[model samples]
Target: MKVINLFALLFLLGCVVSCSQPESGITNESIAIIPLPDSYELKPGTFYITGQSSIGIDTSDAEMAALANYFNEKISDATGFSLPVGNSGTIVFQLGDYKELGEEGYRLSVLADKLVLNAYKHHGIFNGIQSVLQLLPAEIKSKEIQAHTTWSINCVEITDTPQFAWRGLMLDVSRHFFTKQEVKRFIDQMAEYKYNVFHWHLTDDQGWRLEVKSLPRLTSVGAWRAARVGNWWEREPQLPTDSLSYGGYYTAEDIREIVEYAQQRYVTIVPEIDIPGHSMAALSAYPEISCTGGPFQVNVGNTFYTKTENSLCAGNERTFEMLDSVFTEVTRLFPSPYIHIGGDECYKGFWEKCPKCKMRMQKEHLKNTEELQSYFVKRVADMIRKKGKQVIGWDEILEGGLAPEAIVMSWRGVKGGIEAAKQGHSVIMTPTDHCYLDFYQGDPIVEPNTYSMLRLQGCYKYQLVPDSVDASLIMGGQGNLWTESVPHYRQVEYMVWPRALAISETLWSDAQSRNWKFFVHRVEQQFRRFDLSGVNYARSIYDPIILPHLDKENRLKIELQTEVEGLNLFYTFDNTIPDVYSNTYTDTLTVPKNASMLRVAAYKGQKQAGRLIDITIEDLKKRAMEPKK
Candidate 1:
């Protein structure tokens, strides 16, 4: 691809355009940047990138040169200029030892003539580059070279750094496989919001999505599963007649490619092998490692607990050997200092019944199955530690006894996180209520089918560091996107965004600096950018919050509210689609005697801001009778 020069192209425009005033009601506060930066001062003149603009970096330093090239390629798409790293360019990336700004901190000075980004390390420079991109128009994200785009950046003095080091997002690929390209896109989005950790949930009971050379059947058998798609945990069970042909795994080459790609963005790839429990797929491949694991098929999302086994038998020596083989390959494949060993929801029922488990318990002087689970985790932790990688797992690993040198990823709630932090272990506080992106962020009636609700408001308001615990022990938090309900890449974008943005902000920005109203406004601005980039995002929070309540007269009444203010909720009892011209909801509604259904929608100005939602009177009655959330 030929690199376009920015200077010649801008010179063709005949004059330098350097308007510093906020154009068309756009202000500093309205900038749609996710994970908002700490401090910035808007200047009088704008920095219009011209063909003469070049990225200045220490060409002798390979890493700095690479970082400059990354920014060069990004701007080249829109600016029509493949900026080179020379002695001194208008855009400069200077690396130095500025300890006060921290390793991931940067100070940027943008003027009409030049933009200089100074940082203490490579990551800081990279972060400054992202802020610059955000300051520009959204067209910079276009894959194709845009012909008529004005690549103008706001002139400003800015200093920013992350509040937490472990800003991350986890994707569970076992439930629904995503291609390598899709995974790369996911990582790119994470890096956009300054998330540094890519937690790859590689193995689960439903399927295994990683390859181990020594364990051939792990992918050949465990990675493939019978196809079943519906609401997760409600799909049909895999029968003997079912053929396992609807799954895929990442090859060693694919893993390397993704790791290298993530490295370019300063993102770490943390591979997770959910073990002991969620290992039915593995047992399906090697049944001897399980107690009663003969003829176990990869789960088809059907309910299974009493009939089949998922946990690896703690008593089996082959289990450790197989794990060693798996982790040896995993450690070699990923350069991350940490590996996730999922120990959540392990069923110990089979352990109580199996003779081998009892014998192993006696040999180790274990008190109960909980201790047995702990022993399994400790052994796995040791295995991972020997490979020079620390082990991080779900908070369930804290049961009976905490493993040595292990980090706890608290998913159940803050209770487990507090427990882990008090014990002097580093903790990642990703409580389910705040950080589970897979859950429904809107009403199920209007949103895609998914269980539970973790609203964008709830996520944005999450207090990550508990006051009672040692704040230093808190290694920061991340959002987990379990792929149970998310089946494809497009839907993945729909489920993650807006909410993931909330998580990113919570993890990156300080609690005191965050304001809910301001963040929502910024999110609305981001939605416009997403629209420009053709990225899917949920606007369901703007939809009316339909609630069924009983009046004093024992009649079912409907109440509606919206997460966003200024949205006009219009409703109709006659079941016609509601629009702005329809009856406005000023008060609670009484369901008409013969009305079959009620439809509601929210509007801003003349445009439909939220999706239309229909609720049958019968469903409303049923909801009224149910317990309040």
Candidate 2:
């Protein structure tokens, strides 16, 4: 009886020791922070938040105090617990002498007794606070107070910093306007991921979305366009009898509010006033500024209105004067040092036909319409410089000759970015192949109809700085969300997330730190947070991509692939919806001679995991014969 009791006691003690130890296998993911920290060390134990827990910040700094209050409010809103702000608390934020941490870097230590954040600047502290928030339970993201939720963080030490200074996301509001509240929500989500730049594409052919006080017509007339239905690219042109109103714009007050909101979140708003090209909306309001003198209407369709002469007239002095007035107001409204004057795809055909343009080109000794475009861009750059701001334009600004001080936003591809960097100009890499969030991320049949494909893995594998260019000239990278087909804010969220998450990690974490499998796991964790916050995100990573290729005998073959593992891909050649019991895909499939169509689906265990993909034999043949994009 004595021996039996001793053995039982030893077994109980062993169970206690095992329970106290940290979860087996320590990794950066043990903390589960997205855009994983530069370095981290997980320790045994957890930091518990009790009713008496408080937040401490440097009381001497006004900004720090404000940030502390902001975090306190967030915590209170989340857990229904009021965390008082004082000089001493369980959680402490202190300014440190760690100059090596840089302006946006922080050191976070989550001890069993207390949580401490150390940084040299307010930006770093803000980031450190974000890390702390991420460490909390996913229930903390809920807007409503979570009841009986355990607010605890695993003890860990993290030293974090962004790999690139410019981690950005561009939102094209011209295509589909989002309200001020929605914009704020978008910024709030971005801030959680440590994104620092918000490139606001404020103008496009579809509509002009920013208000210029001196140019009232820009918002009143340019902001609205005829409403269209169905596919954006297939929509009919606006007729005179059509109701020419289906959009909105931000007033000066609205702009000021949004700017303040973004500033509070440490996001710089870079406003893009697309020029020369994509000026149909602006020209509709002020027709005299275009090369073709006519009454123009803001485009409602997604198709490029190139034939309509949307380019601003370089020869017209009124064009310059109007631009100057617009820029004057824009510069005052936005505090960002760089203004994007879009110089992309400007159809110079009208310039070639215009007598005034020809005469101006002759007087300026310009060789071609491209040179004329360069002349216009240089002049615009000069105007921006006068306002103590720099100018950034699409890669087309490099045509003929780039403006001496203009920055290049390379959207076409990395070639454009490399060329700009070689010419001693700063470049922001946003090639469509990787950074365009509007592209279909999953199988086209399973995802919203978009022009191209950009897998999440492709985005995570992006290299911002090519080997040929100097790293200093590369300002960083951004993901562009062109909302041509996205009509609602929910759809925008679906398109932006997951892929945007990949871009965030790519821009913040070191390249060598990337592991697609591990990143997918982190994304799954974030998905829970999104669910709690009621944010829309896509789970198309499980969808299989059907790759059509020709065999050695010229027979068409279909290859199935998925970015994530453990998903069972099932297919049928008879065009029937696949189920768990369907034929499982183990290797490349040969096109059956009598097969008219193919249908594929993904499943996890007994449940359907992704959308059904349907493809015809003719479609496969056409895809196989098509030239490589």
Superposition error at 344 for model 1 (Å): 0.4
- Lowest lDDT sum, 10 consecutive residues, model 1, at 7-16
| Model 1 per-residue lDDT tens digits across residues 1-629 | 32112211211111111222222233345355667777666778778777767877788889998888777766554566677678689999998878888878899899988999999999999888777766775344343545556567667787888889999999999998999988988888788778999999999988889999999999999999888877777888887888888999999999999999999889999999998899988999999999986778888888898668889999989899999999999999999999999999999999899889999999999999999999999999998898999999999999989999899999988999999999999999999899999888887887777767888999999998898899999989999999888888888889888899899999988787677776787787677566655567888788778888888888998889999878899999887888878999999898878999999989988999888888889899988988876
User: What lDDT tens digits, residue by residue, belong to model 2 across residues 255-352?
Assistant: 99999989988899999999988999998999988777868889888465556878888999999999999899899999999999989988898899
Q: What is the C-alpha lDDT of each candidate?
A: 0.83, 0.83
TM-score of each: 0.94, 0.93
- Model 1: lDDT equals 0.83
